[model samples]
Target: MGAPVIGAALELLRSPRATAALTTTGAGLVAIAFTLQQVIGWPGYLAALIVLTLLLVASLIARRDEIDWHWAILPISLLAYLGWAGLSLLWSEYQRVTLISFSYLVLVTFVGVFIGLSRDTIQVIRSFGDVLRAVLLVSLVLEVLSGIIFDAPLAVLNIHGELAEGGPISGLVSTRNQLGLLAAIAVVTFAIEWRTRSVTRYVAIPSLALAAGTIAFTRSPVVGMVTVVLLLAGAALYGIRRLPEERRQFAQYAILAALALFAVLAWVFRAPIIALFNATGELEFRLKLWQRVLDFVPVHWLEGWGWIGIWNSASPPYSGLTPTGGRPHDSALNAVVDLWLQVGAVGVFLFLAVVGLAFVRSWLLAGRRRSVVHTWPALVLVALITVSVAESSILTEFGWLLFVICAVKASAELSWRSALSPRPERPEPLPHE
Candidate 1:
């Protein structure tokens, strides 16, 4: 009886016209809602998790046609080692804690690959961005309303200088830094779309404004935001310098537009914007954190205490949140530290090789001047790598989807016509021989 309901529900979700983009965005919203529910002391997060998990399962089953050999192999290889490390050290004091931490990584990696590589992933991501943009816009509007209708608390957005500390206006996201990172990536996505003229300048302009709005609400977006701009600008400059004389004008115009856009962003968020530059404490903390991580190398030079030991060893058992015996300050750096700590030299080598190959491929593909055909996904992949430095997106659903799409796009480019063409009939070859 219970099984029938589950089957019907899955069927409905997996239907052809169901739209994975909507499904993806729904998952994000549910996750956000879940986080907020926790802050508000509600039990909604569990429900949201259940719903999103079911949706993901249904979406996969419906879109089973998209699966490939590499999709399963890569993530499985990474997680298997992580699992083995965790299980091997289960007798240790940190066993339970280590399992939790490894679970987080496994979830992120699996979803990241799935979403990053799916056939319509780019489209799904674009849709997800649109929904996120709308949510941010509404939040901004509410901030204005709350300011006018209510008072000081909602009016003045508190900018938490530290990435670890997080900001005040973050809606449902667990960290202010994570929310800010998302906003920054949203801007990068729109910036690329706008530069390519796939989306109207009107849409892109407001999207930038929305990004600025999100940044104003959360101060830490600047680091990721600035890095994204510089990277894209550098790529554009490289592209333009290599362009023929005729195409140079368009590049020139694009350069000018980028300048104008940044000028506007800087002007609008001038106060909080400058604060990002002024925060010495935050900068000092990151420096100290990195140094501490380096110090651990001599001690845990070989196989680490195990997968979860870094956090479990801490007093409160929360990595950055606890501020005790945790591995590192940043999520991205934590991955690096964990790799070195848990798997030793071999794991580190494998990790670097995988990331390096993906990046090199994305760079070569994105840098192509002849076609818009290949450059879009390549550019997105490049952005993913850059953003991965600040956030663990590459280890999550978003990263997986981005990687998968690029892989599929590349595979699609193969010359099928040659393979499909009928072979010429053999005539008197046997007789001649």
Candidate 2:
């Protein structure tokens, strides 16, 4: 490019609105890749992601000195996970899959780090909200065309909803559950944006409504459950925040104590709890899948079968998985169990630490007096944790990307170098004023 062209590009990036637009566009593309992979097709989604990452990288380099470089770095846990995944290729029974998975991890890491480092917490939320807005809007329009006008599914977007026909609308996303997750995040993000008055009422209200509609129409037990849990958790946080400082300190410990007690109680009554749920036949089928996995875990207890979601037939436990389907045992029906089964105990610790640290930092930030914007991180962590226990979404596309973004944002917030790039100082008011 010529000097004038280069100068024009640099000039364009100097405007905050321009920068935000670019950032939000990048975010939308990533959201599409992570949640609507089947719709755009994986290869297309991957291509868009790579291009976005490169553009973000260029922008980062252009404003290198303006950013707090130390806080701009990747999280240690992410580095550890990447390193472990890369190294797993050595002993991995399925070399090809591991290599490809490692590459995908690299792409996701690049995108996550870019978003986290380039923007502040509020901007991160705004950009992410913009992505969800674009997604939900496009998906809704397409669904209307398909389900209502044409009386057929949106084949290109892979949207099949129960709204007009039977179940929840998949929309641009792959499944009803994923759609519900997107909608759930949209609700949280739009609600926070509204509370802060950061976004206009017109945009925020409709987005929130659309998201809520998904929860209702999808009839996804998980999404409904998430909504309830989030509501109660938010209420609890608000109640705790209103408490006196000394009382709040004691309350925190009490909550922890309560959790510890509950753990023990649940363990003691585990058999009955299992039996109680088994009457519904939900736990029975899931447990059978888990049993199939746990049965062969001893084969690679320490090293694990390597860090790929898909297992090759040659791999021991995967080979032993019955019914002759490659999709067998993809999820242990639990994120922790899935992580352990894929990369062993060490991987679980590293991944969980990443999430735990993020949650802790976010919770602390949200605890500040009248810090409404800070709630974004905490609310997101709530969704991530709620999904982690019941599904392996945290290990998959949007879930993984969202988790990484939260972790990176949390790490940035608590970083020691926050003073390095302090906001531009405001001028003092006139003495008469």
Candidate 3:
């Protein structure tokens, strides 16, 4: 009886519908984390995450035989970073907070690993599209109710109900910039869905329009810059996909060189560029905050203060770093700076390795794969990385979840282990539009 019951449970976990349901739920929760925290508070939010993580772990164990163990090495940098974070507990200024925060990070990472290992790239994209569509639709409806219908702010959710005034609205997320980032990612997912014909035109078109509307209303300069970068990246991938295999390698190198030169030129003309984005005020605020963070970094320059993923208001250094009226700042507003403050220089190097390798692998896969779906991960990474320069979103919650999924997926395909062993057979390519 026990054996039969256990077998049934395992069978249920292996079902495709079960995988999709879990993926969508996980993505939705992470994406609207701030909303969840505000609505249900920390206890409820943590409960939901814990439940989701347990279920995903069960699913992963049930399908353990299906995963290629060699691919474990593919996420070596990520593992190293996490390991270093865990070790920081020994030296953590606030050991209790570090333990709690690090646990939250692990829970989110497990969900990402499960999705990456279980779903194909197209399936992952579909799951994200479905979740984002629902989130954005609900956000818009709430904005309407608050701005036009009730004409009052939703104080609990931090939504100012400014949609009626052509928002700098926060929506259901924490800030206008966050909403804009999610909307930008939604745009990429919706476009890929349309190109792949994964969804009908009726669905895809409306989804794209909704995402675009959200981005326009948010009025976030950081997101605006990210959107431009995403467009350029999409165009570059589109062009590279058309090149012959032999010339593609050369083209890739040439493009990299051009991008490096462009980065230097952009830095040289950063004053005008800052004005162009209308982000002069935003840049000034970040520069001041970053300077404060840097000043404190030398105290623990090598190992950092500790691995508290999100800032704790009661903590010593984080509490006093920046003044925001009564509100506590959660991040340094720069991912690299955040890393330097939390995990120090070594953590920063490991993190760069993780993102750098993930982007290169996904970018190459985008160029070589025939199906349009392959481009999704690369474009999404472009958005995430660009936004990271101005926001530390990638270090926690939704941003971290998406980064892990992309990095794991890319590593599964392009890991060096593939060359050492027989390359695992992949699913048939979707028909190119």
Q: Give the Cα lDDT of each candidate.
A: 0.51, 0.70, 0.87
Kindly list the per-residue Cα lDDT of model 3 for residues 1-433, writing each as its tens digit. Answer: 9999989988898787888899999999998999999989999999999998888888888878876665644488789989999998989899999999999999999889888888788899999999999888988999999999999999988888889999987777778888899999999999988888889999999999999999999988888899999999989988898998888978877886887799899889988876766544888777778999899999998998999977887897988875758434688999999999999998899899999889888888888777888888888899999999899999999999999999998988887767877656666457432
lDDT of 2 by residue, 194-265 (tens): 876778899888889988877676666667667877887687678767888768766655654664596599
Error of 3 at 401 (Å): 0.5
Best by lDDT: 3
What does candidate 1's lDDT look like per residue over 227-300, in tens digits? 45646655775676588767766665666566569768866996685567546454345445546655555555
Off by over 4 Å in 1: 1-11, 26-47, 65-93, 138-171, 174-176, 192-202, 221-225, 228-234, 237-279, 308-321, 324-335, 338-347, 368-433
A best-first ranking of the candidates according to their lDDT comes to 3, 2, 1
lDDT of 1 at 290: 48
Error of 3 at 205 (Å): 0.7
The regions of model 2 sitting more than 4 angstroms off are 1-4, 34-36, 155-158, 260-282, 310-330, 415-433
Worst 10 residues of 2 by lDDT: 424-433
The candidate maximizing TM-score is: 3
TM-score of every candidate relative to the true structure: 0.64, 0.85, 0.95
